[model samples]
Target: MNSVNSSQNNLLFTSRCPEVRDAQWVCQKVKNTFPHISTTKISAKMADIEEANWDLYRKFIDKPEYALLYNKNPKDRKFLRLFAWRRRIVKRIHDARESWRIGGKDDYHRVNNVLGQFKYDKLGNCGEDAFMAATILRINGVDNTCTAGLKVDGSFLDHMVCVFNKDGSTFNGKPNKNTIIIDPWVGMADFASNMFQKYKNVFSELLIGIKPQSEITFRNVDEVGISGMERFLLIMKHPELCYPNSAREFMRKK
Candidate 1:
């Protein structure tokens, strides 16, 4: 394993940060958005969810966790979906988006800190978005399970994505088959519904999915725009690369 200090110094202009700041941010979002939720004990209703529920997911997320259809799940489901990737999913995601800002929305989000780029293009910070998304969902009631590993088709490297589930309460008990994965960056609520007709839609599986359509846009870490979701349909339609173990084979891999 690599020392956290050796990760990178891309954001020398920034100050020190906590290892789990992202997790906290996620929790914050959940609290703010789902004002009605007071740590309620939502019975694990994985069965209530169906294949058509994904459309509702887009409305909750104001910006980007870059979540995909498969990523989001109830707490119980996250465990069943995540195998070895569970222990560090929350940590890795929070760390991935750790950084400082440089400019404004007009300017592209520059790298203040980073470990590796998915394709060397900047669409705000993917890791931060995922961390924020997962944290918010976890706190609000959605159980998000993710994986930090190589993609099977040589489309990308050192990647992470959420998988949905039926139940999502870690404190309740052992893991269950209630989680599923989603790429937060894939869908933009601002776009026409038909425009998003293609591209894998995985929101329907969860009790609730969040996307703030009115607040969707790519963010510039430096300026007045610290909030927004940059649409990257190009990612799913055409990924860069993946390893021999694609997500579909995640459980069966040797």
Candidate 2:
């Protein structure tokens, strides 16, 4: 049944959904084209353009969750520190493991839907976890993307990771000038160092980054050995996974 709308609950409904969707494209454009752009500049621009349309989006940006998640509250700065390594960040991951359930096999869900279940103290697989982390970072004015890769061949995603940019010359215990790979589930930041943590040699290949401006495309994702009924059930349960195949041929090319 359709529920009555009030100013308190109508913010999301009255706001144009396409505006937020297009806002993603705008953010992606900034990230891919000018990765070195200042976070303050990006945040300001997004606030002017996107925030005008979605009040809830703006509220999420101004929230103190980033500080709480990192266990550091900077009075002067609005956004969290980039690539700032804090002990509480790791502790948060470990604590989350205790509350979030290890979801069933092949149970993929979108970031928004997976986040909704969080109120019930439920969790999803690696992909869901990575996407949720990426969303939080994005809301906190951090540029991030959800990445996926295959295990071997004709198999589901072997692992998922969130990629972001750090302004300084080093991050996550690496000499990266920009890119930093973060695995929210395992609390691993450096992929080169944590190769064996999630899966042995998972990053020995390439994985497409799902960012706002990304144009990566896929075909025949359902070519796996799973039966049609099983695949249909999985898709019905998690419609986001049915949108486009995450696997890319670049891994095989490498």
Candidate 3:
């Protein structure tokens, strides 16, 4: 892993950072376009965020210590099945994100701080949140896909999330008939409808099933002043920053 990191860093920095550029553009646009957004609107956004955080905390983090005992016995098929079926782990991941944000972490989220050990002071953004959920799902022997994609008409593929099947089992290593998507980044809002509102016509099962490093190009990307190659190179660097729980555990074992 260290060797791989060395090689990736050695890749030339000839391209602009799409994430950084797009983020700055967004910030500037918001500042310029809505110099004085209504306090009511801001309060509503905060309310939604708070509601999601509250649900996650009550559902997962606020539970009694004995609740963990269910996970202690591997042979308890009923409990394990129940555990795997419900969205508790996903909620925990969401709780971590809320805690991280509330603690005032920076935008460039560091994944290790949240997943390996819960650090309220060091939080992660959407991608790290999704990766954390994916790690937990994988640990529980659940089938899921962690994805990265643009907001469909947008220039940057800046979000990441975990997509899963309604039934835990996969058909021939592919997602089964009914697929459910979970975005810890978006918190606990009705994810399906929220996703449709954000991604609209472009998000489909095809995006969920997309293989790693799949090529996708957005029209009018140059309008953002970043080329497609720059976006590609930027995304290539992101996965290296993610410190999934499995990787952290392996490091501790070493």
Where model 1 places Cα greater than 4 Å from the true spot, the runs are: 1-123, 143-150, 154-159, 169-177, 188-254
Q: Per-residue lDDT tens digits of candidate 2, residues 8-100?
A: 343353133332222333234323321221222233344454445354334434764653365443632223332222223434444554444
- 1-254: candidate 1 lDDT, tens digit per residue: 35344323312311232212222333333223322211111212422332234343333233223332345667524433332232244344344334333242221142122212222222223343343344333323333333222222233332233232333333221223332233343322111121112122333222122232321111211111122232132123223211123343212212
Candidate with maximal TM-score = 3
Error of 2 at 39 (Å): 36
Tell me the RMSD of model 1 versus the true structure.
Answer: 23.1
Assess every candidate by TM-score: 0.24, 0.29, 0.30
lDDT of 3 by residue, 99-177 (tens): 6555434212323344332333232444555545444333333433333334443345555555544344442222333
Whole-model lDDT, candidate 1? 0.28
How does model 3 fare in lDDT?
0.37
Global lDDT of model 2: 0.36
Worst 10 residues of 2 by lDDT: 216-225
Q: Give, for candidate 3, the lowest lDDT window spanning 10 residues.
A: 217-226
Pairing residues by index, what is the TM-score of model 1? 0.24
User: lDDT (CA) for every model shown?
Assistant: 0.28, 0.36, 0.37
